[model samples]
Target: MKTILNALAEPNRLQIVELLRDGPLTVGDITDKLRMNQPQVSKHLRVLNQSGVVEVQPIANRRYYKLRPEPFKELDTWVDSYKHLWNERFDRLEDYLHKVKRKEVDDE
Candidate 1:
């Protein structure tokens, strides 16, 4: 998970992941879409692949890159663990707001 996060932390790698979200693409396709040179795109792709965020499939001479679902699913599960904490805080905030509104009405 740390590796995955580190890979995605890079802006260029994140963009590559976003591009792959639509579908698999070759290095050339990513380079053209991002207006980056082939070497730069390839460097980002290598990091993504090493971090297990993306997988490469060699079709003849060209390699197609696509996102792997496992890392994302793991990340989702980790983030979901904090959902209850967020909801509890929001609920308390709502209660406080209501009290403030009531106090304002009484003062008026």
Candidate 2:
């Protein structure tokens, strides 16, 4: 979890993960989409791979990158557990706004 979280902390790495959500991409494809140099892209990929958030597959000399998925699911589960806190706060705010509006309408 820490590894995945740390990997995702980097903005470029997050974009790379989002890109890999669709399908595997070669280094060239990633570089083109990100408009970054090969070395920089490769460095991001290395961190992602080390964290197990992404995997690399080589066909001939071209290597393709894909998201591992499980790490994201784990992160999602962790986030899901705390989501009700947001839901509760939003519900309270909504109720308050409704009452305030109703009071204003009645006064008017």
Q: 1-108, model 1: which lDDT tens digit per residue?
A: 899899999999999999999999999999999999999999999999998999999999999999999999999998999999999999999999999999999999
Supply the TM-score for candidate 1. Answer: 0.96
Cα lDDT, model 1, residue 40: 97
Residue 91, candidate 2: how far off, in angstroms? Answer: 1.6
The list of candidate 2 runs beyond 4 A from truth reads: 106-108
Q: After best superposition, candidate 2 residue 63: deviation in angstroms?
A: 2.0
RMSD of each: 0.8, 1.9
Best model per TM-score: 1
lDDT of 2 by residue, 66-95 (tens): 998789889999999989999999999999
**Alpha carbon RMSD to native, model 1:** 0.8
lDDT of 1: 0.95
**For model 2, what is the alpha-carbon lDDT of residue 1?**
89
TM-score of each: 0.96, 0.81
